[model samples]
Target: MTQVAELPASAAEARDHVHALMATCPRPCGEDALTDALLIISELVTNAERHGGGMTGFRARVTEDHFDVTVEDASPAHPTLPGERPAGSVGGYGWHLVRRLATSVAVTPTARGKSIHVGLRLR
Candidate 1:
């Protein structure tokens, strides 16, 4: 199934929406993949709110083999991860985690902003 939500000021709101989407999945989603998906949603939405100048849209698509997520924000700046996270650093870790959790990630620059597309394996 597919689900979409307007990007909200609060990351928690976005997180809840993603959870609702996952709950509607036609097939059973494993705990590990589900957890990873939720964390990815939280990180992307939070990043959009904090650095992308707020989120514009969010979407998710689920299939037998994989789940896809796309997040849009108001800034044209694409997200990037550091070569390596410094030990003991608390922040600036979201993008790195997202990369590791997602099987594939793409950044597309839009007219007014950018969209981050992430694909996660379901199995």
Candidate 2:
């Protein structure tokens, strides 16, 4: 699958887009992989919305073995994984979780803002 579009800053809207993409994805994805993908997508979108000052663009690509997701936001501040939080911390988990789940992740800073790219291997 290959598609790109602008997404609202809202997590709910981002989730809706993820679900629709999954439904029509070119290859059948295992439930577990899809769930993981959803979680990663949610966190990325949420981070873009909450920390990046709102999402400006979203793109997703799925292949037989992996999926790639990219999110662009309006803030130039690059995202960073917070230092180890105390156990049971209430927040600061999004970037960490993305790093844990994705096979590879990258953040690119642009003149206008930044973009996050995550690649997850299918189960």
Candidate 3:
């Protein structure tokens, strides 16, 4: 079974919510893994806010070997991985970071919006 939580656009609040939920996992998840998970959550939530037409909320689910985090918003357009980052690009690396940290990622259209889910393995 997995646990779930809904969160708003605030990155800090989303991170805190993820931390609290991850703490309940049966197998221990290291600090680094937790940090990565939170960072990915932040990226997803931020993207939803900045581009997804405003975030409806987010969900966090923990399984035996991974933490599944999903963020949903009002837009159907999914996030894309930028091919390259301009020399001094101030932003636009969220999806790239997520791809690096997560074991797997899935973006699917929902009834009302879209959900970007990242799976972070427990180590």
Error of 1 at 79 (Å): 1.4
Expressed as tens digits, the lDDT of each residue in 1-123 for candidate 1 is 666656555778766776777777778888898899989989998899888988888877777668888999899987766655566655887898999999999999988799999999888
**Candidate 3's residue-wise lDDT over 1-123, tens digit each?**
457676654988888888888888888788898889888988888888888898886778887678988788899986765666556657777888999999999888999898887888887
Better of 1 and 2 by TM-score: 1
Model 2: worst 10 consecutive residues (lDDT sum): 1-10
State how far residue 48 of model 2 sits from its true place (Å).
Answer: 1.2
- lDDT score for candidate 3 against the true structure: 0.83
In the range 38-78, model 2's lDDT, one tens digit per residue, is 89988988888777888888888776678789999899887
lDDT of 3 at 80: 64
Select the stronger candidate by lDDT from 1 and 2. Answer: 1
CA deviation > 4 Å runs, candidate 1:
84-90
RMSD from true fold, candidate 3:
2.2
Which sections of candidate 2 miss by over 4 Å?
A: 84-90
* Model 3 residue 95 lDDT score: 86
Q: CA lDDT of 80 in candidate 1?
A: 60
Residue 4 of model 3, lDDT score: 64
After TM-score superposition, the amount by which residue 91's alpha carbon in candidate 3 deviates from its true location, in angstroms, is 1.7
What is the lDDT of every predicted structure here?
0.83, 0.80, 0.83
Clashes by residue pair, model 1: none
